[model samples]
Target chain A: MSDAVVLGLDVGGSSVKYRLASATPSEGIPEALAQGTVSTPKHDPVAGLAAIARDVTALHRLVAVVVGIPGLVDEASGTVLRSANLPALDGLALGPALSAELEVPVGVINDGRAAAVAEARWGAGSRERDVFTLALGTGIAGSHIVDGRVVDGAHGIAGELGHVVVEPSGARCACGQRGCLETVIGAPALRRAWNRAGGHGSPKDLLSAYEAGDARAARIIERGAAALADAILTLLALVDPGVIVIGGGLASAPHRIVERAAALVAERATFHRVPAIVPAILGKWAGAVGAVSEARELAGCVVGASAG
Target chain B: MSDAVVLGLDVGGSSVKYRLASATPSEGIPEALAQGTVSTPKHDPVAGLAAIARDVTALHRLVAVVVGIPGLVDEASGTVLRSANLPALDGLALGPALSAELEVPVGVINDGRAAAVAEARWGAGSRERDVFTLALGTGIAGSHIVDGRVVDGAHGIAGELGHVVVEPSGARCACGQRGCLETVIGAPALRRAWNRAGGHGSPKDLLSAYEAGDARAARIIERGAAALADAILTLLALVDPGVIVIGGGLASAPHRIVERAAALVAERATFHRVPAIVPAILGKWAGAVGAVSEARELAGCVVGASAG
Candidate 1:
């Protein structure tokens, strides 16, 4: 038995996760030798990265490692340019630093892009060639996967779907833009939309209310779906992919939301080829799967590792 | 003079364009090819394809041939699933038919994606690792390029920027979706936007008036830029490319429009590294250049073709 193993790490605004696993090409299970999550160290990216490296190294013997960060990263350069949520990590040579600490080939990627890689290789998106992953987390950011390659634009930023404006003069986005889709569709957007719809409750409450036939809740959900659909439809018109994978916390929304969003998209999209909208299959382990997947690829494994 | 050449055809909704005598890759001239544009056959798409095949075969001696269609084309399967503008050509075996007709290797691609190929290789987008091309025509469409390859989603549809809704409830688009950016940002949108601003005139007239400092004209231009900028910024947050090349007729709008849009994006996009917004270097001929460039790639030249 080959004793080769790779360590995958997913770093987010709130937490950092790791998995030690063995993988091979054409396999999906990256047999996890160990797995765990920790509160991001110090909320400072550099400290956070160092802490993550230390923890993962301690857990297992790894042949290679990969990290997924939550900000603008130059995957080609292996650096984290900046992240508002994890400030201390800005301008850090994360890949090189980790490679030095762990004494193995290390890789870094955008969390969303990494998740897309996971999906493309081993998840629902495996069926299609071009897949756009919309991570409806605390904020809405996305990754566009074309030809099995994630789009890292000229400046290493390409899939900013959340920032696409859905309201010309609507809500003020954190980026200072008005009425971004992220403002209307992300978790915070859902909350605001619920509030605007005259509700005083969490997203779950509003969703439950909507499911129970409350017109106001229904209206909020409808509005959010419609806005998201508009964005998705536009994406369809631009890049008619076979399917769209909607992930993150928002994936918890009822099938009705996804259906309605798809309907809205089908209604506006003209080119006839509409992408099927589905929830991401990777679930909570998407980051871990993606991170290890990247490591394996860096190690010249053309196939996927099985999940533990 | 190694007079290597390829026949490039851009099959649009209303017409078919042909270019002949392209220069070799070593030669510096972007596409040293003579050109021709003839009305697409007045008959249906099947007949039109036959017509194109006849024409292409007539010119097969040139080297290779490539056609850019306006629909959902599965380049791998060589199937045209749906094309709203060219309904007659839907579901045809474009590559097989043309390849058989010309008795040579042929390539078929989406018009916008083809343009991105051209721009990425020979146009202004040459420097960026991942670049996006936004085409503002009778309707708006876009293409994404990553690692010098077109971003074809799982279904061969990836760069549908126009359909993205900048306004969720703004207006109904031809695709049946309301508030799509194309509904308000393309030429038709510009015309409608100009009219809504209290002017009954063509886009050219409105642009002239705006250029002359007419308040109404200026407002229209300003509003268009603002809306467009909102879209660009949002995209920036999704996929931070190094640069964005603006194409289509509307790009001819006053430079102020691009500047103002950039300003709006800078203000609002917070999460991702922003890229510079620049005018398209390849003009109307971008599609042709891109078509020829794709054909050149298929023909396997030593040096890659130019994109711009």
Candidate 2:
């Protein structure tokens, strides 16, 4: 029974989330251990990680530890190649660093990929063999799940959907890419869009205005939907997953935004059956649940290694 | 040894190709049994299938058959739901039909998906865990291989990359959709592009001319490359496959066209490494080899079931 326990960690640009869970695929998310907060060491990610690790190690008998970070990670080599937000994470062997500190096997995954795993396992994509999960958080990201396995790129840096150029000469993204959908749809982008439109409000407020039929708010939601729809349609053509799970803070917008995005994707999908566009089921627990799932996966790898 | 042989069939809109191979993965491609042509069924469609059954029965024995067709195939149910090209195939239980005719179990798959399986197992993609095979033929189609398995959609209709819209209002496609990459990059579109450039040459002749530095041919190639690059860059954002196998007739273009297309895709990729673009080595035999691979997979399923 102790082997079923796992420590799952989701390290965001501004916050750190963790969950303790039973590692069995059928086991429900453990409720006994849960802790999270806005990471105070954003300026010094290693310090923040060390603090997080100190907290995580207190949980008894972890089967494995899993962490998802916002960056290009070479999982095979256990190196964080790059991330603008977490500068200290770059070049760090995150898995070994945390593993040494915690004295347990650790598995590292891309945050988007971890979210996709959560969705594929228990959310809208539960029944799908192929699934795409989109996270519209502070920045946009996506993960491709095929046949129940994440499509980790050859160099272990897959699912960088946020940086894809929708327009050749559009806005410049912080990633040094122009016309990226992230610039047009991410949370920061949403605020900028609202400010540019002369609409003074937060995204939630904008959603309320949009519900009240404010033309500017509606236009803002429409633009977000259109950008999301285009990317979804493009993904539909390639991945053709059964369901698309839209998560992150942006997805909490009014119903019209999700409806419009679904309609647009449906309209453009030709050769494939338009997949279901649904909100992710994990909600606030997505990162934590995903981390536990990652831990379970790593446990399997460990068992396989020991057997071999 | 004959008990190890299975018939592999690849059905297309206008033609049918086939292969005969042993049931084991290591049996590889049997050179002597590689046989194919445009599938011709004289008289009634049922009669045509009977004829194919007879030909296949005459050539192989003792293992299940695998068929890859251009349509929406439910592999579990052994049904072809909607097929634009083969009206005779719609609503048909292809597996039962072939099983009844040949007295053997059969597995059916989408041709595009089967092509990816072939590549992942034995062709250009064998080296990578995540690879994509795109066939730019009469239609622009693709299949993804992630961790050595095809990501069959929940409904078995994933990998419809051609149907994804590159332009919201670009061109009408045969699937009753507008702006599909197929409408802009397929063979007919490429031919029209060549014609629009006032080049009175076949695809072959145009390739030679481009190799020899013909301005008109170069322009046409450039246009095709742009469309293809746009579609590829978009897909890269979603799947982030390590390698993309460019197959089918259009890939026959001289090295320059391929290089140009690669450069365009690379230029558009963001943050992540752009996938390596290369021609499929299996050429016309890809579908046949894929069919054989599918047959082996199906036979394995049967053996596994019997064992269980």
Candidate 3:
């Protein structure tokens, strides 16, 4: 009972990264006791969770699990509402299934929002009440935390900033719109930009090249940063948060993109209070960390967290 | 005391519209007892309020007054934070000063949000909780009322949609931003389009031409509708409200714009719920009517209102 540990699973399109955190982590102690990653099963998420549970249980006393998905989630029912990339998980009662498998209380949330909760509570945005967290992954994931809680609009679709139409005539987006911020600055766009700029392997490669003073890479990064600034301007014009916390894949190299984007936003802001822009402190583990926070709340461990 | 009427004043750049409403009007009885308009004093808003109060008090038993200004307002201090169009009223503690002048309790609010309060409680948005009210007049004014209250974001500049940059590479705005929605769709733009099309005395003339099936006017209307759709889509992608109430000068031509904008938004929506778009019923009187509501609220008549 004293060694209770919570499992945090960040479910992504390609892989599932996990962290085992103390149920009641003490001050000066690392929250994440152990962390690892596993290839996400293409079709059977249940089997994947079962396998992870089997392995994690053998090592430590597992109490509860919190799962973060890169999609819309029905928090009340713990159902993955819609996952474009991870369709197999969509419409599944993920929490119930996982809870049944692990024999523990399970919590689920949108991965972006999960990251925001982590940042809002313990990371870059801890100092602020209103935080706009942009998680730049395979797709843009946005979460707006107002007064330490993610704003759920009339239809539970508030803070979906990735879909903000940036250019009506630019390009067709997967969301049946033209020129969403996602179309311009999402990971797919970054990959296309990287390939178009003659850099191969990954977005990291493009970032490396840009950092090393490559002309084409610089242009690509510049364009991305500019687009990000445009998105920030839109957000500022509407929400006017106290700070913006950048996370996910792109934020790993904050110096490459966040700096330029912040500069561009400051230059463009006319009637907006230019908020403090900072990279997330939780890094790649933000989703997992935030999921754990939700899990702690779910197990009745966290006092004021919204839901499990 | 039963005959005590509240004076509702809507202070615009060019005119001050006042409405005399019964302080305790029975349900189903007409709320507004009388209404009139006068040119706004260019040099001194204080003198303007004093003149109105002096006249209103002489005619009827005036209990209190509510004022709506087209600008950012510090509702707590009753100070006009910023008014771009009416620079005369900027930085003035209009409520306290006017209360002193009129010798009555005064409530002040942002005109756009005041209009939204009218719509939300007694107009098109009465049936819904989350309402996005877009008042398209000389310049666009916006309000997002979440759960029957206006969302005053950080710095109280939440719903400033006029400055949302629609085109990053478009024309420079007065706000020092490029291609603001204001630059493309505000009154000047509409007037320019009308003149450029070789016909125009007023925007109403262009609207008449548009209604009469003039090709150039139709094109201009279509462009405005498309831009409205773009702005609506941005709003939907972020804060998907339950209903969108279109008020102000443009809503008078609802069939020409609101209907077309709704269709465009519905057509473009992929991951958004197409909300009901309706012309505001209160029309130009919305600000004044809502100002009365705030006056009631300020006098401690409203039990749940945030502030005056």
TM-score of chain B of each: 0.83, 0.83, 0.84
- TM-score (C-alpha, index-matched) for candidate 2: 0.86
lDDT of 2 by residue, B65-123 (tens): 77787777888877887777888788888788767876778788877777768877788
Model 3 lDDT on a 0 to 1 scale: 0.79
Error of 2 at B115 (Å): 4.2
The TM-score leader among the candidates is 2
Please give the TM-score for the first chain of candidate 3: 0.82
Query: A190, model 2: CA deviation in Å?
Result: 2.8
DockQ of 3: 0.60
Which candidate leads the pack in DockQ? Answer: 3
Candidate whose lDDT is highest: 3
Which regions of candidate 3 are displaced past 4 Å? A1-9, A12-66, A82-88, A97-106, A167-171, A295-308, B1-8, B12-65, B82-88, B98-105, B167-169, B296-308
User: Which candidate, 1 or 3, has the higher TM-score?
Assistant: 3
lDDT of 1 at B295: 75
